[model samples]
Target: MRLLHTMLRVGDLDRSIAFYTDILGMKLLRRQDYPEGRFTLAFVGYQPESEGAVLELTHNWDTASYELGNGYGHIALGVPDAYAACEAIRAAGGKVVREAGPMKHGTTVIAFVDDPDGYKIELIQRD
Candidate 1:
């Protein structure tokens, strides 16, 4: 079966939306608020959801923060130029935890950036 979407609990919906959309160059594919559940779900991605998988940012009305236990790893996004992507993200006020460079024990270029809630996102360079 194919993967659908990755759900992340964010503290500030607006801030997280900005980071994912503006900084990462993703589009807000779809969004809906679950009033009964006291939460909102916003899906973001590089293109329309009909094209491929996307990310779901879930904002619980009562949660101001999340632990993000050690078991969770970072989400990765493919880029045409890792170095240039990192530079653009930085210029847009995104936090680049790791500079773009060759990956450890490998030649693939990669970089890391942090979201509003401290979730790590990896940028991998692909032809």
Candidate 2:
């Protein structure tokens, strides 16, 4: 079976959406509000959800922040050029926690950017 989506709890839905769509060049696949649960879910991805796995951003009406415990690792995205991708992300007002370069102990180039909710997203250069 194929993977569906990865869920992340975001404090600011609009900001998070902007980071993913505007900065990361992803599209908002779907969005829905749960009035009864006082929360909202927005799915986004590089392609149609039917064909690609997506990210689900969950915004709880009451939560303004999260701890981002150690249990969660960063999400990875394949890029034609990690350096170019990182530069674009920076130009788009995205913060690059790590500059694009050859990975430690390896040759694969990589970079990192953080989401509004503090989730780490890794950009890996594809050969």
Candidate 3:
């Protein structure tokens, strides 16, 4: 079976949407509000859900923040140029926590950016 979407609980839906769509160049695939649950789920991705895995951003009406415990790790994205990606993300007002460069003890180029909810996204140069 193929993998599906990754769910991230965001505090501010609008802010998270902007970061993923505006800064990261992803599209808002779909969204629906669960009035009874007091939550909303918005899907974002580089391609349609039928073609590739996407992200699910869940916003709980009453929750403003998450601890993001140490067990969690950053999500990774393949890029043609990690350095250029970092630059573009920064130019778009995204926070680049690590500059693009060769990874530690390895030669693969990589960079990191943080989302509105403090989630790390790793950009790995593939070609």
Candidate 4:
């Protein structure tokens, strides 16, 4: 079976949406509010859900933050140029946690950025 989507609990739905859509250049594929659950889910991605995996941003109406315990790692995205992507993300008001460069003990170029909820996103240069 194919992978589906990764869910991230965000404190502010609008802020998270802007970070994924505006800062990361992803599209808001679909979104729905669960009134009974007091939560909302928004899916964002580079392509349609039928074509590729996407990110699901879930916002609980009463929760304003998450601890993001140490057990969690970062999400990775393939890019044409890690350096250029970092630059663009920085210019767009995104926080670049690490600058683009050769990875430690390896040659693959990579960089890291943080989302509104302090989740790390790794950008790896593929080609």
* TM-score of each model, in listed order: 0.96, 0.98, 0.98, 0.98
Model 4, 1-127: lDDT tens digits are 9989999999999999999999999999999999999999999999999999999999999999999999999999999999999999999999999999999999999999999999999999998
Alpha-carbon local distance difference test for all models: 0.94, 0.94, 0.97, 0.97
**In angstroms, how far off is 6's CA in candidate 2?**
0.3
Better by TM-score, candidate 3 or 1: 3
* Model 3 spans with C-alpha error above 4 angstroms: none
Candidate 3 C-alpha error for residue 90, in Å: 0.5
The total of clashing pairs for model 1 equals 0
Please provide, for model 2 over 26-88, each residue's C-alpha lDDT reduced to its tens digit, 9 standing for 90 to 100.
999889999999999999999988897999999999999899998999999999999899889
Expressed as tens digits, the lDDT of each residue in 13-89 for candidate 1 is 99999999999989998899999999999999987777788999999999999999999899999999999999899
In model 2, the clashing pairs are none
Clashes per candidate (backbone, < 3 Å): 0, 0, 0, 0
User: Which pairs of residues collide in candidate 1?
Assistant: none
Model 4 clash pairs? none
Model 3, 33-78: lDDT tens digits are 9999999999999999999999999999999999999988999999
**For model 4, what is the error of residue 109's alpha carbon versus the real structure, in angstroms, after optimal superposition?**
0.5
Q: What TM-score does model 2 achieve against the real structure?
A: 0.98
Q: Predicted candidate 3: what Cα RMSD to the true structure?
A: 0.6
